[model samples]
Target chain A: MQKEENKIQAVIQINDLKKSFGTNEVLRNFNLQLNEGENIVVLGKSGSGKSVLIKCIIGLIKPDSGSIKVFGEEVTDLSHDNLDKMRVKVGFLFQSNALYDSMTVRENLEFPLRRHWVQKGKENVNDLIIEALKNVGLAETIDMMPSELSGGMRKRIALARTLILKPKIILYDEPTSGLDPITGKEISRLMLDIQKKYNTSSIIISHDMNCVKITANRIILLIDGTCYASGTYDELKKSSDSKIKQFFD
Target chain B: MKSTILKDFLSETGDLTRFTMSFFREAFRPRYEFSEFLKQCYVIGNKTLPLVGITGFIMGLVITIQSHPSLKAFGAESWLPSVVSVSLVREIIPVITALICAGKIGSSIGAELGSMKVTEQIDAMEVSGTNPFKYLVVTRVFAATLILPILVVLSDAISLYGAYLGINLKQVVSFDLFTNQIFEKLTFSDVLPSIIKSYFFGFCIGIIGCFKGFYTINGTQGVGRSANSAVVTATFVVFIIDLMAAQIADIFQIT
Candidate 1:
């Protein structure tokens, strides 16, 4: 276990969130709270509004109602410029590892840094890119393009790119999805390692029970649109609720 | 088979239209991702050069050869380079480049975003305090709008070279004399309207392609459908806009 240092406060708070697409209510009165330095897993099947909930939190899709706050600042309604600036503090590792196909891994990791850091004079960019790649265990894949990477390696590279900005809150949308079991376990372990190394609060979106057990300090299960339960792994295992039991089975 | 194909086409088109409206709405709302924009320019412009260049060259050469004998019937073969340059610069290059981009960038965007949708990357961008619409569409549209004109300038120049090479195959004309002839009869009216129309062509390609890709429906098939629709629709719009621009130019006695 990593020692708690600086011990930042609750990084994200949500209240009465709601969203709908046409007649389908994707989220109904969704709410969540995440403390800084904690690893929280959101478990739900595909289209159960798990991903939708995170998208709202990140301000990707504006909610029809309710609010989201990061570090006590309302993130949901920020203007474009302000919201873009706010995004610097939040990191997301996309499930597909959305690496820019046009760039080499070195260029990929260096991209954000070159834009904000090198362009704006934030010391040197190469060292930071190297450091980020090293952290993700992709140091040797530096010169290769995203197309050249294996599925698992691509995810690691994506994670490295997310870490380049040193965000205070990290969001993972199915970080282990579509990987082989060995690779999936590696990714879950990597997530834990990243959480400890960065000491940042994390919200991991996944339906994998093993992933939830390995990475989360607390698990929030979304059934339909609302958060059905919030508890530790041990409590979730013991619960007598049919749906919760189904999740275990 | 026909019913299935028609049903697929209609549904795909409907989704494309929906995605396009959302993009326009999102574009006006806020934050421009400038870094993403620059990266898109490099992708949409830099990487597309060789393909667009080769197409432009062949187009210019073909135009010079086919139109040469007709003008020769009137004993106007000296107008060869000038004619090809004007048509290539003012019309063919931009339209063809757009269609090419429609194929390359459009399909790439569709495939990329479709995979993201299926794979949940778009959702990840959203949850990470990022607006995927602004991150994706704005950057792409901006790239198409800004980079198309420059690429046109480059392709036009190269195509004229190819046209010159084609002309010299049957006759002798120095580069200086050909350019001098080209510029001598090339009025602002002929030059301006053509370049202006190409910009719109570029914009249409970018907008339609991004719109389709962003709104991609279903699984991988949705992505393929968007890519196809974007190219087909953009190609049609290019010709329509060209006609409108030409008629407007005619009102002023231009080419």
Candidate 2:
């Protein structure tokens, strides 16, 4: 809808993106634009290539042909070092909540900072870790291994790790998957709080209708490797289109 | 079926070679993982030493006891220490130690990395702007390469001590005389080639284990397959490398 508004800047732009695995096409002519400070939930069923779309944005999967420009720099054209530098601003939360089993929660949070050789401003690494943990309300879990945490707790810890870098853009791959409804709601609310606190733009890949309703400023439905329809949740709920109605049902 | 099998074999070999070349490329570059390398060395070396020691002791004892009768029958019993020292130093102990490491360390690295790959930790590390290959693969391979040689040397010493114990069980050869007999027959040629070959064994074990684990797909079941194949492939490669080392040593007239 904002496509007509030339005033707002698009943080991420995808134009005619295409990707395929051998003969099976995963993405075809998929186009999207993520505006600054907006939360766009990419709604799709399993194997609908929602995950693949975000991966292409982050350069994890190379698209067969397309243009992905994040902050006006072409992603596929960037060299390895430049890609790594670009990733520092782009946070990706895996569906599995990929916490390192060998590390304590504090160590997991510290990994990115140390890896990027990030210099802190008047605050040491410990303080940053504490701040990140406090933001997730898991300050007590600093010393605990990932195995010691529950599924919900692990997801929160992983979110905390992502927050440590204070990324401008956070990509959530099924952020509320594999949890009870209550925990899932709690996580969805926490995601809103993070967006407000950090003012981060996000692309959330999820099928949970409740999650989509809670987090999406706009929703894009992915069908047949393309954007089938997109609108506000209530707007899509009122539509009579069978493909879009199936999702609501 | 035959063509498919051959194609699969060739594909696997091609992948492994590329993996090895990538390792070498990253290994010489800067941002080396020194702390991780030291930690891997500790895990691969200190933890596995006891197993290598016990095996070496048993091997030395059994070989000495088995060969004593043959020597005594030919009136060459006095050459027990000399003969056992040469054989143990030149071939047996090195091969056995590498095989043990291939089973223990190879399977361990394979399973550990395979699980990490399955759980998406490696992918997570990549998104965090950290090179997982440098942090995980290169450090482990280098640790295995450096540690195996030290282990082989220690096993050689322990095996000689066991040979002394085996000799003292039947005859009254003094400790000083046994030591002298071993040293007199043990030349640089005998000690050097075996040690060199152990390095190759360590390199192959480390690379093969990492290769299997890094490319693991199909979830937990794939992880199990990787660990099993890591042991089997590493064990086979150890023998092949040993055979090649023996031939090279023979051609050079080192023995």
Candidate 3:
């Protein structure tokens, strides 16, 4: 009964999802569930379909078959407008940060607010931008452009932009791919702080074991177009299976 | 191999048609992007004036100087102003201005959007609950369509002035006589069709550039390809449209 209740509390659920580009099958019969306030790390190799999985969840790439349910709503069934509304609740942080290069950091953060038609007084909007930047330790960088920021700073600004909406769920793709060890660890710790502060669920795609250790409450290992194994960072590290052992070693 | 090329061509045509239809459908919806539209007009209209003006002036002067000797041989030197004015108003100025814009504006839009696409900025906009198509494409296309006619009108007037100067170099003709000769020869038939066709030219440039840029792939290299193809395709479309416009005017006995 407790397990069944846990399943009901899932913020995101995917089952038997299949997606392919031409003959190159990226995901086949993939399944996963993310419950409320939990950070699930999707660990995989470079071409192991981690990004594809995130794209499918956000409806950027449609699955060939199967279902994706967000808060008990079928994602595939929603119209364009409804899908856009759903995007408001699901924030996605791209690997490249994808900040509008023409705009300042403040404008980039305000984009989601204006986009979703969240009406607020000018003072309130400024407060929201400042609060988001402060959360990412970037309150000083608001007037700067994305080009002027360092890689780590750009990533933080992107996170602040994503957090500005206070999304119920955040999907991060390769959050620590290009950063140095110290910067990567900082980002991972920041991820934890945000999760604690907002109680938001997240599915983070990464190959960095340190990031997985820091941010993951649970980890899903994607290999050969399927979820090969899943457990806590310690649980997976202790597995006797050769494929699972390779990651820990 | 030929078949594959044909298939690709057909696919692109279909996609362009669908893109154009979507632009029309979303353009009339509520919450129109008025400020962005104004910004685009300012950029598209105001920025191109210097280039268009220079090109129009040169076109008028050269056509008048080159054709003067021929008209003089036929003892029709007085016909020089009317001939140059009619040609400039009906075809040369609008076509040249559009081709210049194709090179300038089309490539710029393509590169800008292509870079945005490769960097995932367009996807980010969409995922942020914003309408990227309505915000980016519609405003640009609308600006191009509305602004090109005004540009052509301005270019025609400048070119006529250049022709007046060209005539003065050869023989003494008053500014009033030259102006009278131009207005007398240039009719509504000559003026309206040229203006009408320029709007289509602008639409083609804006839409083709957006389409190429929006669908960019293969990363940075794709950005270069999109920008290059946008100018080439836009310039080609200008010629095709001009040909069709000329034919339609001929059929209607307007030219």
lDDT (0 to 1) per candidate: 0.80, 0.93, 0.93
Candidate 3 C-alpha lDDT tens digits along A1-249: 998897788999999999898998889899999999999999877788899899888988888998999988899998988998888899999999999998899889988888544568678889999999999998999899999999999999999999998899999998998999999999999999999999999999998889999999999999989999999999999999999998889
Query: Each prediction's TM-score against the native?
Result: 0.77, 0.98, 0.97
DockQ of each: 0.28, 0.79, 0.78
Two-chain DockQ for model 3: 0.78
- Candidate 3 per-residue C-alpha lDDT over B90-206 given as tens digits, one digit per residue, 9 for 90 to 100: 999999999999998899889989999999999898888878999889999899888888999999999988998889889999999998888898899999999999999999999
Q: In model 3, which regions exceed 4 Å deviation?
A: A116-118
Q: Evaluate model 2: give its lDDT.
A: 0.93
- The positional error of residue B93 in candidate 2, measured at the CA in angstroms, is 1.3
The prediction achieving the highest TM-score against the true structure is 2
Docking class of 2: medium
CA displacement after TM-score superposition, residue B203 of candidate 1 (Å): 2.6
Query: What clash pairs does model 2 have?
Result: none
Give me the chain B TM-score of candidate 3: 0.98
Off by over 4 Å in 2: A1-8, A116-118, A121-123
Kindly report the docking quality category of candidate 3. Answer: medium
Greater TM-score among 1 and 2 belongs to 2
Q: Which candidate is the best by DockQ?
A: 2
Candidate 1 per-residue lDDT, tens place, A97-210, comes to 877666698876765564375364644577788889899888989999888889999999999989988998888989888888889899899989988988988999987777
Clashing pairs in 3: none
